[model samples]
Target: MANQGPKSQTILVVGGGIAGVTAAIEAAETGYDVILLERGPALGGRVAQLNRYFPKLCHPTCGLEINFQRIRKLKNLRVVTMASVAGVKGEKGDYTVSVSVSPRYVNANCTACGACAEATDMEVDSPFNYGLSKTKAAYLPHEHAFPMRYVVAPSAIGTPEADKIKAACKYDAVDLEDKGEDFEVNCGAVIWATGWEPYDPEKLESYNYNLSADIVSNVQMERLANHDGPTGGKIVRPSNGEPVKKVAMIQCAGSRDLNHLPYCSRICCLGSLKHAVYVREQYEDAQVDIYYIDLRAHDKLEAFYQRVAADPQVNFVKSKPASIRIDEEGRPVLCGENTITRELYEAPYDLVVLATGMKPAASEGYVPDIAMEQDEYGFLVPSVEGDGGIIPAGVASGPLDVSMSVQSATAAALKAIQAVGPKS
Candidate 1:
């Protein structure tokens, strides 16, 4: 694929998250042929699973749907779901990407009818809910999946459940015999919009994440507050299903410590603050305690900090928690030294939430072998002069919130467009 020849005008984006979606749409609408590949069964990525965004507190569906519509209208853009880039060969404008695709087990003829779901009794952990609940073996990723198609877990491939699911489909969209395949796509430039994942809370040995049923991560807190979530939008204790009236929000959990990430995630402070709002808005008498080294609510976000602080029920404490212990009363007791008062505090609450940081998607399994430059925090940042043909966008470049990610994606689109040049 590399003859040192003039490169093709095709641009390939190897992620279908917000960043990938924005970059693809911008480049394609600007008149370049673009291909978007998602490793998951559907598009929308982490944004699809969010209850509401910070700052504005708006549902993520509206923004995602608008992007989906824009993509549908652009004939230059082609979306391929359940596909990932396995390898890359050549350099700059001349590159060949090896793409491996997984089977969805459901075909385009699918009307998204509920027949297959009704036929399956087998269930698996729902990744959409951060594994807080289980889902049918044959189920849609979520109500607002971009392609609106269903997927079958690999465990059901040769089981009787597979045959039952296929038989129940009236449109014959279920294809139990569909085998995954690997293919190649040649493109001039590649945009790495692969986003980040929540840092694993289990690694924070001091927090006791698994020891207490009510101690959860910030991402899980989003699900618990979601109407479609397992608890049906009520912030309740998973242990006894009791309403949560008093809560502790621990900021910088597993972040800014040499033992862990060692740098500020940049999003945790705002995310934890948003969690506090969700709790306050739900219950009139609910009390929220926020523990943090400092509130990094910079610029426009500082106003929001003041707005939340005005609430009498929400109290801010300056401290990095030393440890969490489930007392004899079954409450999570937080132990720490308050830097402000120079006092050691031991407080207990109905629920404990650890605001974990973001770990780059590239740092994880997604394109783990990509030869891109990363910052000290494992973000794929482009140099001032820029990488030749591979552009990094969104959290893939660095830790950023949704709005900042969109702006980064737009910048990446501009770079990719410049690399590929105009239609000849």
Candidate 2:
């Protein structure tokens, strides 16, 4: 593709999620100049937040490492993290875009050293750690994270540690004076793959997610299951840190409900099932139960479901738990009617995981002036006209698995390339 000569075409990809990353890689491979913007500190997006992906059941780092390598090798692709698209001008074949990038203190020169961390006494709840763990003022996002650099949380740095960190950095990469900058770029096409954020469980007061310690979201479950997780990969009751003997997965926590997200987040069901298996593997004595309206596994996913179900430790209950409450001893109690039995009953467990759904990241006031269409749910809808000016992929368009997200990203890249048109 390099033999086609340098085509002065540019495509701007918004969001650093799996879809955005895939689109950038594919477009750059096809010889189009690609620019990727991410609102987070790094480019892995929500995919990076996940523990093990389904289908292949591979750790996210396994696949993301390969993409990170590709990004390192692709000289034409430029990624701007901790950045946001401020505005847009022009249209179609040519557009002028302005972006605002926040200061991360440390930069590419960062060697992921613990020096800054050692010098700082400030501690904050790590959102990247799913709120289960804490990190120092200066810390890497995670072990084996791309860019392999420490990011200084300016907000978390207190006055004393802030000054200490400034003095501790040996490479002079720490730039507390580095304010955010805005710049413009010219692009022929744009891709919207901002991806989704987990639905806030506080909306469902019935689950008492914020009030109860044992009630956690699927994302939190991933952190609990990861070897480097809060509990060192031990599935335990959050209330007492006791090894959990019984676990329950509540599917459609914020999804498939008319009151919240009316659409079925396609991945939650399978994701919960996969976590169920993880729980069983960790605790042989653990009895795992999944409460759902339906299995909802599509295509080849049913095969994995069958394999997991046959494991004998998992039980599928076809009823949504109406309420989750803590018992006198701090155990989780699920109250709901079993559709098969047509009887109201309560099942007690040591842990309860809400298989929450995904919602558009743009809901939090992150959209730029690209003039694209979104569904009623705010998911970006790709143009059917094949004009190639705008591209949409991944959960930002709708809920989809990682495999499907990657495939959609490839399609979006092709569309972006075609939008550049053939050189005369």
lDDT of candidate model 2 versus the reference = 0.83
Measured with C-alpha atoms, the lDDT of residue 382 in candidate 2 is 55
TM-score of each: 0.96, 0.95
lDDT of 2 by residue, 128-197 (tens): 8778988888888888776677888878545777889878988887777777788877787788888888
Q: Which candidate has the highest TM-score of all?
A: 1
Q: Write the per-residue lDDT of candidate 1 for residues 110-152, one digit (tens) a residue.
A: 8888789899899999999999999999999888787988899
Worst 10 residues of 1 by lDDT: 1-10
Candidate 2 Cα errors over 4 Å, as ranges: 1-8, 368-371, 383-387
CA error at residue 196 for candidate 1, angstroms: 0.8
